[model samples]
Target: MAEAVRHVQVIAAQCTAMGPLSQLEKAARELHDALTDPMLGGCQARTGEYPSLLIGDDLTPQDIDKAVDAVVRQAKADGAVLVLALLGHGFTPPQRTDLYFMVRNSTTQSLRSAVDVGRLITEAADEPGIDGVIAIVDTCHAAGGVPDAGRLAGGVRAGRSRLAILTAAAADQPARDMCLSLSLARTLKDGVPGAGPALYIDRTLAETLRDQVSGQVIGRAEYDQDPFPLEGLWLARNPSNIANAHADVVGPLGLQDLSQSVDMWRGPRRSPGRLTRSTLLELEKFISCGRVDDELDSASRAWVDDVVTALLEVFRTKEFLADVLAGSLTSDLLRSAGRLAGFPSRAEGTVPLRDLLEYAVLRAQPLDGAPWKGLARFVAALLHEAGISHVDPRLQEWARRLHLVTEVNDAFGEFAEARQRRALRLVVSLVGAWTEWPEEVDAWLLHGSADLPLHQRFPCEPGGAHGVAQAIGAAMMWARRELPHPELLEHVDIAAPAHLLARWYPEEEKVGRYLLGAKYSVIPRWSGRLDEAEDNAEINDAARKALKKMSSCAAAPVEWIDSDALLDRSALEYRLSTGQYDAAIGVDHSPDDLEEVLELLLPFAPIVLWPRSGTRPDQDQLRGLVQERWHELPDGLAAAYRHRWGAHQHCVACLGDIRTVWHDEGWLEFCRPFEYRVVTTPEEEA
Candidate 1:
């Protein structure tokens, strides 16, 4: 009898509803083409070879059921490995909720909910030839958020077989649509072996072969049944990793297998005294970059040890001091060197005390003025290594005085504009209690002496001593009344309270009003009283509001563009929710005409042509429109559109509007309406 036919199904179901469609079809077509190309992952087998089947279909209740049944039947009949690629909706709602998948059904014209997916497990548990199952879920569960580990673990348990469930995101993380699958496609077309370095995975055939070599080890673990000769199995985010796993699992398929030859796959070249000085130099660079991972190869670990030894030797040398002062060496490496400076400072050494404070200063100077603030926290680690008490009065004072918290805040602001101030607040909260701070820091937040530049700064608004008093009072009341520790606020001085209560500053009020009217407001809650837990969140919301107002007011008004009638209002609103508007328009302009609308929306916009259908756009016309526009788009936008537009239907903000356009391009140009403010000078507007 012929062996079970190998099967691969890459489901590019972008639709969360059974209504109008666009990118779902495109993704399906792309998956279909990928499956047909044998050079991709489709391989011919020997002796009753298992044939491969690729399924690219929209996900619906009925569709999901059929898919489940088809996969189960194929697994039983072929006794072959199975691969399922799912790209759609999945996420955890607020308050640690269960993640859910959106399954659509067109006959009923509605979305179906698929919870605790069980097809693969049921078939593996029931069949004979089926080696194992590999399932990949690339979608947010709810509100574009990932479920927690507890939920994923529970889902795995529900499968009840030799099953492997892999998600694109961690349980508590949200998944994003493939950001550059087409650009990756072009790279793949150029014949790059394995999957290109794209943002997401979609090599269906390779995944199938990968399953063949790895066998049912993952599923066996799930079933609590380990068989003989354990096969290698892995969960990876990159396609190249899967390809590497494939070669590792198969192991010398033909005459290539030579018993006498050395095992290159066993890791590194085994040679006596392999730790050379040259290798040690390279190791120093890697460690300084914070590239140390627990998953390093044996050779790598040995090399790291050698480098650590060399670093220690350098620190002991007088010549190293000159280099440190000249800004040629890093403080982090210097600290590491300091730790290794003593005879016991080598990789295997046990140095009790090292001058890490000096090390931090040295490192900070060279790294463009302490570029990453997280490195400052290494001081604590150095102290711990030296066996110093973290709670020591001297240590706490030192920690607070480092100004590392502010440094970290600045770093976060550099990384993300929307969350900049909030990130700063979080850093302060996290590291405020450190010991090394001067009394002047708190004194600045209180009353300051006249003519003293630092003294004029206060924790609350300027010239609002009353506001500061009110904030202190409210913080104390809330701590005493609502929080877990009433004495907490008492312990916390007026320098930095857990929360603050102050009347909205005029500028702040203006920003908030503009945001309150915008479709995608930055403020999370409009009417709620500010409290301790909500303080940071409130700040972020206010900043977002202010930014929008400033952007909108600064842009010179163009009379030709009708602000109210620009682009489909619903589509524009959807675009706003996804942060797409910010990307395409900048803070300068809005898309009021078809050309601008098409320019911004076409790249990632999934066309929903409306006919006689209720909410869904007309099917045939929509398909034609998308097919026609697919190749006409600009290259950059096309790449971006293909990457982020798929699998956004049924999103909380989507509201099942079929004729909708969701723009997710990173248009950071358009001035936002909430950013508007009265300015005294043109320079201020500029």
Candidate 2:
């Protein structure tokens, strides 16, 4: 006995309450074309009041119901898989939660006259012998209409038949005009050509339709029963399916197809269009399941090459890189690729390591390169882990062209000033390969010399000046042991002094004096001159010891200057009284000396001192002096003196007092008379 062939039947209907001007008619035409297309193997009977199942303008509620009934009856008789596509305007009545599909004669006031979706599904479900049902709804708030339809259909089916529902939007979302319909039409057109034998809507096709309609109109699919039975049950043979069956033999050609599809739909910006979690999961599974063994045939080789090419394309995109950093789809793909690359334990794969290194090098090729530092850091670490003795040509070129050592020095300088510290950190991580590249290490030492304050010139591990100092010390140690270049070692030695100078001379300098004064001060206890021979011997011995220690580390020869003049109380007093402030303010005096000088000078001229260190004279003594002599000075001179040093009130008062004294006494009154008259020039004297 021969069995009868069961077929698939498609019934498409559109509501046109807005008449000929309505877009529902156009949506209806598109749905009808998609259904009856040869690829779908849909049966269209011409027995109804309308020639075909497409219900549009002039169709009343009664006519729609009759048409729907006839289509269902024919499909039931043939035991066919039935597909229902509804495109129309939908209505929600005031104070009502339910939605309705409006018929041509239906009015806003008489929504009950419209087709209730729940009732329509119940009618379809009552019919016997229908294999399965796929209802695609394109009306506004179509998802809101689905629960009722599913519930009503469940009662009629009594668990005997299968039902699947696809809606254009969620329950609360609206379906925009033409967007849902156009996407649906396009999805159906594309999906039907890939339907294998049995010709019924499957999960793949349903998901494909959902992906296609996203952003334009968000759609969802639900099934009343297991969906596995419906897969590949369509009547038409899909050529693409035949190709996919031999996917392993074709190698990675499917990836190329996927890449092309992504490019086509990704729009002008090449954005990550509608790449959903499901799509990524499917791709990952495909790659994982189709992975070949170590031995490669021509086809497998091609497959591996294409896979790498596709990944490179993905890595180049900003959107994809963001996903990679976020540990999203790209991360997953890389992990799977990594497993295939022979590292199954790592989450991020190593297959793309070489490609990423090359990409980073290319980006860093220009003089002012904009390399992705994070990627570069990863590549450097990976190479270091592999114990590579020599640098890759691409990496070497990047280092050579960009002068990465100089970049690190610049970043370190900015970091010392509390600016962009991350730049320094990134550069440090990227130069992990410097040990393998001797030229780069030498370059770093040479470039580091140009910046003053050693802390600002060397890479530190986030600690600060001390951290930088330690890093430089460690580098020096390494260079002495590992580096053979004499010049490089010399450069390192020179760098050590900059660090020492920074530590010792940390204060700001004005002229030859330090703002914070010298770190060590000499306290003179003797007021009288010592024996010349003993003093000279002692000073020379001390100078030699200091010079010996300094010469070893200093960049140039160290020299000590000698002076014959002795520092005594009388000379100090004379300099202070005469307003020779530089000599009076000792080279290494603390701020207290400035005060003592001002106190001594109060009895002499109205002196305003500008010392090398910019330290002001003692405030209290100056004020007391000014107060004591306030009544003796003219008002104009006192006011001028006060105004001149008013910023430091004590200095102003001292100036006022001194002006009173100087005005009353002559400028030379404090100078001593010459006691010794020269008799050597007796002839001139006579």
Candidate 3:
């Protein structure tokens, strides 16, 4: 295991814009040197990365954004003690809601033109995975950056932000030039006089920095709300000979100031790392894409409590895991964790539990659909056999996050990811009457969730049976250029409003002309749902239900709404939205009558299929085919068509109106803003 790095990152920013303020520059430089001192906890700013913000006449929000993002990201760790020392003037905008680090070009109206310290410091202070913060703000209204008490520890359990904030003055007052920064530097460089062996932030250091400040100083820490108070932070070593004499003796090795001597003994430093909530969330979404889950519904939050509990158990006894999970595959899987990603250094043997957990999460988290032959595969297999296969892929992610499992199972995971034929999503959206050629609408052939969609605009003459087919043909031709194996596409999911669904679309590929309708298994979804906010509770719940119901494909069919039941739209909406229904079949409704079909069913029912406008095939055969090929979904829809298209009467029912929807709400979530789960690979520090 790597030695813990107490001060993981040191960032000191000053906004002396037009011309440099010599005193602020000197203080910020001194603070950086003090924090990076080997004796004052090991933080080495040797990555050629600047330790201070480079503000000037040319400064822009973009520059500040990159600098702040890089620094805070580097400090992501459960053991990290981040030292944020700012020497700028803190200016709260008119509303006094957002505090900005004022520069020569800064203003209140356009926040983008200024460095909003609230966005920069206040928010970053409470982010998960940061163990502690020692913020020394030396600007006017410095107290503005201090978050409300207990706010840091409120949202999460184990990854709580416990920190001591020391500011130059009260929220309404002005600050003395560089007083707080200089005081912290001096206190750290020269140990606290007559203090304990290790300096703690809240009690000792806060008082020291406060006394050194010219005027009143404000300090805040969240210890009152912390369930298990963090261990005393070794921020600085105490050199007081008198204080040491009365202290419980350890040995002569406890040095007051090892400024010049410590480097001679300690080996080269390797940075300590912990998975942040954002990175873990991204990994969860990446794995859960195109997958279904159940609704015990812990999906909304990270399972920090679980991993912490497991780590505690591992600490009690190495063999305790085996005893707890006697017959299960969990113990057998964890036995392989020693060989997993290095929680610092890789090896196979007895190791500390904390390192083991970190390694388990770090190694197993694949940011893309790329094949990762790691512990996730085995854990996923174990979960599948427990009677809930693919029921909430997050379960596999969270459980393994709590820690590990055995060797590669390429058969299941590899084929699903690598050899797996990716989807070619075709979307049709109504433009409304405001645009020219009202029938001239938008269509997209999506390559992947992250890839830019290929778009084309064309008018589909209403009731023009060939209009939808011609549009599909054009998209197919364009899509084939991109696919390495053009022949490998299983089927296409057409997402459209009811008018478009009312028409029949034929598939005319180079292979031959065959009615594509034989293949579609409509899964309802609306493009507008993508516009809804992430915090939309109603949509989020409905989407989760849709994702959860995907597994019901294998279970016996529960209920399907028919034409008579679908007539009363309100009644149908209530039944479907509140309860889980597998499919919605409309046998007699015309395209005009079905205008509101998607709006009502979308995001609720996983599958919705209505046959061609004219034909009403035998209901028994249609239901049987749906039940038989339910699990594979849109892909399976094609297989059912190929097996029964035309030769049997059920073929018309299966293929004629099958160009339906498979509106995987999870797909929408990932594509629109995957937000945290962007395609960018995480810069995880090992």
Candidate 4:
């Protein structure tokens, strides 16, 4: 028995066409052939009957709305993969130069205003089980085609989304219509679709089906009815059991026999094509579980070792070789290759590097750790293509060790608490390396710059500007490892991270700023006049007021205060620079707090120690005391501790201080930052 036929639908919108009329005619003809071709095997048997429509005129707002509504309704009911192709004239105004899709209605002679196509594509993503969608826009459209040209080719990115866009021009240039529409027609006629035949979805499907031949129904298996009018190519093929069931009967058939069958099937069959419900159920699985996954697994380390030797015997034979590669596949092959350089991890054994590198080239992650050398090199490739990087040794080493640091990082960053500690050690190790050896560490943070303002730079995510600053601080520390404190400070500035801390800490931004401004200014400091401090007594009084404010900030989750820890570190850096570390004492000393500040400020200071005693330990200790008091500390302070301290161990101790510390069956019964005197627990502490 041969494979059953299936149906598919397409909706092409040629909104902007600057190309010659011949080319548009050619594209239209090609689309028709693509839909009907039998030799090309393009059309699958669609369940619902709806003629594929190609709208070639400019679209107005009314047209756009109608199109969307119709498309949506059909999409909901038919549940067929719909492809819309746009080609036409378009231009962005000189004032607001961003290109938009130039849509027009059949009746409207003048062009309607441009609608941003990005929004449309985004909307399309929400449609369910739509399979794959391709948008081919050749116009002066902004997404990807050239500017002012009839075709633009640039917009659309690959992701979890099933939609793909191919632009005719770069963002800056107008799309080139030259011969594209005709070329597309000719391409479809010849049995291919993309950059070349190898890249064409139609060609790929042909190859997939040809490989499945067992000589039973050779020429009977065609994609569509004809080759001149292009349609969305939908492949229907025999299942493994059926194809192989009669294999013994057809096994002896060779290329010559297969070719003969192809010639015989060139004529129409006697049987009216009908798909069984069982066959439909199976076909559903096959299309959904396409060939991408097969290609990936075949190329995988685990599968390669198992199947390679056997496959080598059939490599030279087109029929066998094609069968080995055909079928609908998952996109995971690309994703996995992109992420790991195709290095497949296994519980059974290690994989070879050759396959891993091939995977890397396909996946676009740095192969062999080449990106860590410097920021310039790391970002150069990906800026052009998203989610691809070269292998950089240092970066690889860091990623490899992220697991260990994650644990402590979770407890400290106090972000989304309660998870396995993230790989904080790798970060620590990297910073240690950078502080210890600048020459050895060469890297650029491609996305976040350390120089940006704290508010602008730091997002709520842990990996935001704050993380980047910490990473830089670590790198600086590695560079200044052997230099004297003053010399090292001169070479590197802690201001970036420190200022972030000051800006966010509630007390530093509010009360602390108020008192400091009053004590130190003849006028507003930004207006530029400094007043001399009358005595240490006056400064001490100001410091105590600031301490009260700092205490308030330390009591809440660090996130509650809208400042960067880096700023606090920077302010502390100034104090250390002027021999005022003694004056700014009394703050938290949790593991999370210390590691965060150390990881944040260590490039500027060699030794950050916890205070033995002070009016305010969190205030005086600043960086150190925060590191020491890990378990009890809140969010931002906790993150600081993890970066500074290796890990948090031992247990939480509730000691009596000013206030009585009481526990109800191991439940904590006291607010933090305030002192406790009588310590009592109804149950044992962990």
Candidate 5:
């Protein structure tokens, strides 16, 4: 039996009286043209070649209903997919909030006379023979009744039927004239080739349209049933004969050919002949003359593919590879090849071998015998040899593909275990150089816990901390090396301490106690003692003189806490309880007591707490303390106190200037007075 033909009905119910809705008529015409065009395989209408029954302003309410009903009946009888496109002005009547599509004679007050879009869609879904329905509404507030329409459409659970509803705007947003219709018509006309042979337009195309139009004109689509059956349903073949003719270019040339050619040029390690300068110059000339065809015909596109393949063959030569690696004239040829292969092509005076290798790995087609693995390995070796410590996204991708860390470890198999650890350290250091902390470190730290005292485990020289105090000491050393200015020490929040502590002591309570001790005890107490020493006239004079002699030296003076002072349990308790860090430090304390105090405090001292200056002990006393201990105090604490005090003073002076602007603009309900709260610190309670 011969199947009946499908039908498409486009109804443009434009209200001519509404000034803004004139574009709806044009949109309807464009949609009709797009649907009926032979390029898109739209059904030819019975009356003529055009494939739409457009219901324009001339159609009355009864005429529109009859026209729509007739189309639905015909579509059902034919067992065809019904495409319904509506372009008009929509309105929510004041008597009721439900939205309606205004017919030619319909008024805002008489919305009942207008088309009930939901009821119409429900009728279409009720038809048993109609397998699919595509309903598009291009009007202001088109989505207002979509939810109800969707529910009604799902009422009839007939055989293998699906309903797709597309709205020009979201329920809350207004639809602009011509925007949705034009974009959709364009997409349907041209078709998205990359999405395969499916006539089914997905959300990706909607997103593309949204990006092209104003944000307010965004469109939405909903399906009442599974859309899988629509996949690979062809609405139109490629209109461009040129694209059709050259579709097989990439397949025939094959990525394997390029990979094999490159391998031949690389040659065996024993074969030592290098590429000549003249050959490189000839390659460069060829690239300069090799132009990409803009016409996009089969012949032009095929020419481009051939030129790229030929360039790849030239790059395979060992001499050319050496010249490129050595920053010789062949670098231009490499850059040109990258451009031809559709990689980022920018002219470079000198191209690094690593970049060329990365480009090859990125552009190589996914095929058997492609040199992606070899190229990745070559790039990794170059990076290692060049001592390049920074990590890039491309390098990260290569690392994943090549299993970089594992390969690096395997390469050092001939060396001792200690040497292998050292080699891993280089890789870790490079990773750390780019990121503040790399996740790779967590695995390495866990696996190599026995070898904890290596340089890789600590941030400072002769690295490795035996305990909390040694870790704090290592952090301080790192601060001195990295931060030349004494003021910068306060800003240095040592992340390594917390990270190491978490791994070393996974228990929550133990980690908390250690962090608290480090935060309160070690930093503030040691900082206070340093302040007291700096205030001494004789020591200050001597330190200033010593500093002048070696102005460029990276090293800073170290203040060693006595072991007895650090170990004093009573003193540590007092400091923690009263927050009086200075009371715990003294020359009278023995080395053992100092060590105990340090052991107690090292865990908490990593995080420094700055006191609120506005509500602290007397303002005059605080200022005096700051001036005396400015250099010894951490930069973060100092800056916080300074900014707080300054802000408080500013607020007090500016209170009179606070005026409510909207109160004078006739918004009487919004004229409300507000008050500010005073900030207080813990020291104020003490």
Candidate 6:
């Protein structure tokens, strides 16, 4: 129902965690005064009761909710618009979606006693007989309230009032000051130069986003209201301006005609009246009340329901909403209608997902450019950013079949690109991959997409490089065929015993073409074996200490072991026992270096860089590269190897000279895929 908003009932809340209470209290007071007083406020003074103010260190979340409900009821009875402001610290709980306004005795771990912003919006919008509702929230995640508030716009509720929301948030992070609320109060008192007969919250929000309001903090506003042709419910009158604000050519600065002029006051920017998912699901209900539709049949309603279900799966998450509110959404993503571009438009505000579809179907707007894959594309992008990608190709096909109004990104193509972007390294180990250690050829099994290993037992002469290379090569080829693309296989890290790693394996794709080190990040690990070896519990304690030294900023610096000291194994072991080195870099390697220097260095030093035994190009270059690229760790070693590849372009065998070995016993235990052993009970066996 369209109601002419008269006076507004102001209800402002302030909750702070150990700070000066005066600033918050003053900001709320200025807002309330601007809404009630006539001269500076620009509104006629007419009120039966004073504005409600809920302020304190003693106020609980329950106190805030109860007070808001009471004020909303009073506003409904008086037929007045409600101006509700929430100012304080907002907390997003661990791994969960909801944004909670922290009050007395509130904690991040639990939110049973916190004031939910979405629930409060639902409360005000659902109240009957209220002329209008306007909410101003200033917190870290204030923009998160936009989608929920947009849902109640003339749909899904019998008591639908005109709803307008302007929620502000700091661009940097967790709001430290009351700049937003203070700026808002000051703006209401001192009206804009180009404003018309009335000043609405939309104009103020635009000012805030542009940083025209305050210089202390840069801000973004998530604004959405009922699609009014002219303006939203008036917050205050234009303080004192001409009957009509206009712009005329400045005769001194312009070369154009002197009489040329343009109207400065055109009112707030126009919106497409974007319909949200909540509105779409109950479009029939909206029609029965304020709107009418002759074309909305049973088939159409069923279609909308199915469409909403799919959209909800993609959009209904704290992660998605919060990310978008933080300006993560792009114009190309919402590129359904030509004019409908940005997430929250610089001029018109947010373009809800269902806006284009609603207009296309109901208003009979043209839908030629729209594609069905927009949602799929958006999901793929979101998943990629969050380090996730697990959408079924069939559901993507289903989206295409229904011909939903949005986009057309190839699911398989996108997934392939995402895998490459992730740069996932495959873990191909003889003992780890196989059910029965590495004895005979067995069937290959691939688990899902991405980092999961392929299992199979292969027959290879123990420590025979050629036979082992071929077995690993066969398994890799099988994995690429089963998965999306070969490029997704960034590199392979083989898990095997010291004997296998000691013998440099040749590339199976071409026998004697190049060595396995040409693969760059082809690392060797033995933690899997270490975990299975006797006295593993003792080994775990040493592993933790090694990890601590690597991660510590003040740990002993990396000291290179002298190649001449290779003959004195006792001296090397004694020097390492001093705890003066967190990492070990070898100048040169011999046939005996692996067991002598490496074995002693393993339990103490976490990072080890060495030249493979076959090639001895230059110890000086290896040492220089290690010194320059020590901080980058795994990636640095890969880069150094690539540089060496270029240096030894004339020699194919030397391309695989440098090898990097990273053994983290802590990480190895943490990522053990199967933690439980299968036991056959007697009753089950029978």
Per-candidate TM equals: 0.26, 0.32, 0.35, 0.26, 0.33, 0.33
lDDT of candidate 3 over 347-406, digit per residue (tens): 111122333433333344466633233334534443434333443555534444444322
lDDT tens digits by residue: candidate 6, 1-686: 11222334334444444344456777766776786554333221221112254556666877777667656654554345666777766776665445677676666666776788777876676666555667777766666554354546544554345666666553234554566677777776676766664566664545643475343333333333333212245566556442331111011101110111101111233322222345434643543353234244444444444344433333333234344335644333333121221111111111223332222222221355354344434444443443333444533444455453134245435555644543445555554322223543332333334354555555654434556666666666665676664445545566654444455442222323555555535556643433344444444455556565433221112444545556676766665565444344343455454744555655555455566766665544454444334434554455445666577544633424556556554334533432333434335976
The window of 10 residues in a row where model 2 has the poorest summed lDDT is: 520-529
In candidate 1, stretches whose alpha carbon ends up further than 4 angstroms from where it belongs are 1-5, 14-21, 43-59, 91-97, 105-112, 118-129, 142-166, 170-177, 180-686
lDDT of 5 by residue, 165-273 (tens): 6777766667776688887777767766564433444575567667767856565555555332322223333333324322212111222333333334333232112
Query: What is the lDDT, from 0 to 100, of the residue 11 in candidate 3?
Result: 37
Tens digit of per-residue lDDT, candidate 2, span 1-686: 00111222233334445433355567666766665553433433232122344555655667667656655654564444566666676666676545577766776678667877656755664456566666767777776555454464456555455566667676556676645667656655554454532334456655666666654345544444422222222423233454432221211222323444444333223223223334445554554554445234445444444444433433333232343234432333433332222221211211133333333333223455444333333333333333332244544554454345334333334333321211111011112221121111111222323331122223454444344434544554543454334423321111111112212221212212322112211111110011112333333333344333322210111110001112354664564334333111112112324333333433322212221233343433333233233222222342443344345444523332231111111111111111122323224854
For this target, which candidate reaches the highest TM-score against the unseen true structure? 3
lDDT of 1: 0.31
**Could you report the Cα RMSD, in angstroms, for every candidate shown?**
24.0, 35.7, 21.6, 25.6, 28.3, 23.5
**What residue runs in model 2 are displaced by over 4 Å at the alpha carbon?**
1-22, 45-50, 94-97, 149-156, 192-207, 210-217, 225-686
What overall lDDT goes with each candidate model? 0.31, 0.38, 0.46, 0.30, 0.41, 0.47
Better of 2 and 6 by TM-score: 6
Top candidate, metric lDDT: 6
Q: Which ranges in model 4 have alpha carbons more than 4 Å from their true place?
A: 1-22, 35-51, 56-59, 76-79, 93-98, 103-112, 145-160, 176-178, 192-686
Which ten-residue region of model 4 has the weakest summed lDDT? 521-530
State how far residue 398 of model 5 sits from its true place (Å).
53
Residue-wise C-alpha lDDT for candidate 1, range 1-686, written one tens digit per residue: 11112345555543435333344445444543553333443311111111122223444555655555555444444344455555555445456444455554322122234533333334434344455554545454322222223333345334222444544444455444331222223333343344432212234433432343221111111232223111212222234443442221112110011111113323333332122334445545654565445345545444444334423432332232333234434333443333322111111111111223222322323445543232334433433434444464654444355445554344333433422221111001111212322121111111112222111211432224344333333333333443233222112212221111111211122212231112111111111111123233433343344334322211110111123335355755464445332211211122223333433333221121111112333323233232223222221222222222346433322212212221111111111211243323324654
Location of the lowest summed lDDT over 10 successive residues in candidate 3 = 251-260
Backbone clash count, each prediction separately:
53, 11, 8, 171, 32, 3
Q: Considering lDDT, where higher is better, how would the candidates rank from best to worst? A: 6, 3, 5, 2, 1, 4
